[model samples]
Target: MSRRVLVTGGASGLGAALVTAFVARGDRVLVTDVREDASVPDGASYLRLDVTSEADWEAARAHVEEQWGGLDVLVNNAGIASGGRIDVATLEEWRRVIDINLLGVVRGCRTFTPVMKRQRSGHLVNTASLAGLVHPPGMASYNAVKAGVVALSETLQFELAPYGITTSVVCPSFFRTNLGASLSGSDTVLQSIARRLIDRSGTTAEQIAAEVVRGVDAGRPVILTDRPGRRAVLAKRFARPVYEREQHGFARRIKEAAEGAADRSTTKDGA
Candidate 1:
């Protein structure tokens, strides 16, 4: 059966890849993004949506309802990145990241859950990050918001199950995406280092999207995209001390590298 699907931030990154996957499967997809210039997939319809706004979510739901009668799937994939040590991050930065990353998901769920409840059959796939499961340094805002998303999705999984609605939280490791474009932080060196790592080692958005489809099809409540992500989740659960030690070591390395880069830049400027 051809399903009606809606994806927030569908213009690029994982969301765009999701749009492609759904369209290939003959699903009618509504791709919404805050950017008016966002590229729409071949078979998907585009709508302007700022996920932080309840009104925008309402408009999106109305569009889906009017065009498709009801939606079968909702993917809350809209988010922004934030980096910097907690103490150095400004209040405004925290709010901005939280509003888009955490509150956006909340609004999406609040708006669409009722619609799905009326239909009594639907699936929600929320895009979280591996950072949600494991705490990393210099990403206070991102970590908090993503962690909130994971908790929210888990709670929704149980609440929506009774209504014949399935909820899955996608926790992926770094992926090759334009998320860096919106990254905000005072930690320039750390941000640069993180960007390089992602640019070099991250998986393609298309690959992650394919995995998302499989996970949703299988009704997985918590979907980890890569082997490392899966292992991290497991380690966090069954081997806390080991996971903490490893995470601390990784964070220490990143901090050292970032500090070294800052020092080099300082020396060059002084010279």
Candidate 2:
């Protein structure tokens, strides 16, 4: 039987790819996003949803109840990008990211839990990041939130099992996508590095989405979408000393880039 699937942030990027994938599989797919309904993929239905709003989530739940009866898969894939050093990033930035990235997923899980529990079956797929497993310098907000997702997903795997619910957390490295458009941070160098990585990555959203589908279908608990992401997690787990060394080197690069930015400003001022 075809599954009833709902994906948050499904208007574009990885979420759009996911919708297309499920639709291709003959599944009944619903695409929800902050964007206009017109932007939803061709084969999937669209719903105007802002994950930050509880009213929106409640509406989504109601729509599922009225339309699909019960949902088989819920992809909590909505999030934003953020990066900066400790001193450079503001507390307000921290709050905004926490609200959207972390709290957004929390809201999604809570809203749909009752539905799944009533039906006695559901799967939750969360989009985290490689930074969640291996934290690098700069991007404290993003790292923290993604890590929270990982922790939450794991907890739900155990907590929701009795209700016939499964959870999968995705940790994908930089891929070509519109995710960078949402990035906000004070550290120019860190932000530039993130943009460059996104622009230069060979992996595409479709590729990551495909991996996610396969993982979810196979009932995998954790899914790493790219080789770099898998390698990074492996290094962090079994090669702790090496991982620490790489982290230290990355920290040096951040420091040097900051100094370079300061020197350029000083030169421009003097000129």
Candidate 3:
């Protein structure tokens, strides 16, 4: 069935790819982002939205309701990653990450779920990250926000199941895209984390988009885009002991690095 889909951050990266895929399939897609340029594909309609603002969400809802009558699919894909240790990160920075990545999805759910409920049938697709499942290093803010997104998506899935509304949270591995390039102007630790993840990640936006289309078609509750994502989830689940051991090892490495820096300072003083 052709669906009316609203995709946040649909102008670029994974969102753009997903919009293209859906449009190709003859779906009526409304692509929205904070900045809506002429770069989007011809078939997909463009709209301006700042996912963090309530006003923006309200306006978007009104616009969609006016045009599509009601939404069949809401893809909450707009998110920004922040770097550094939890303690080192400022409260404002933490809130900013939460606002865009976590609360943005929450707001989408708050508004669109009612529309879905009215129709008694609709799908909500959220894009999380592999970091949400695994305790990765140097991306505390990003990981924390994504973890919340996953939890929220899971909860919504079960809560709305009685109404025949489906929600899918997509946890994607590192993909080949300009996601890393955009990280350079960001904070130091965050830039480093972005480089490590993007450089070592092997997935592609196209692959993620294709998997998402398939998952939506199948009405899946959770969409893991890469094999590594599945492996990570398994390691975190059935092989919990191993996952914890690896996390311990990672902590030790950080501790060792800290100790090495302290020792270097001590030697310099003695000299």
Best by lDDT: 2
Clashing pairs in 3: none
Best by TM-score: 2
Residue-level lDDT tens digits of model 2 in 1-271: 6899999988888988999888888789989999766565556788988999999999999999899898999999988889889898989989988998889999999999999999899999999988788899888888999999999999999999999999999999999999887776677788888888899999999999999999999999999999999888899899999999998998998889889999999999999
Give candidate 3 regions above 4 Å deviation.
184-187, 252-271
Cα lDDT listed for each candidate: 0.87, 0.91, 0.84
Question: Candidate 2: worst 10 consecutive residues by lDDT?
Answer: 35-44
RMSD of 3: 3.2
Q: Per-residue error at 8 for model 1, in Å? A: 0.4
The lowest-lDDT stretch of 10 consecutive residues in candidate 1 is: 181-190
How far residue 256's Cα lies from its native spot in candidate 1, in Å, is: 1.9
- Clash count list over all predictions: 0, 0, 0
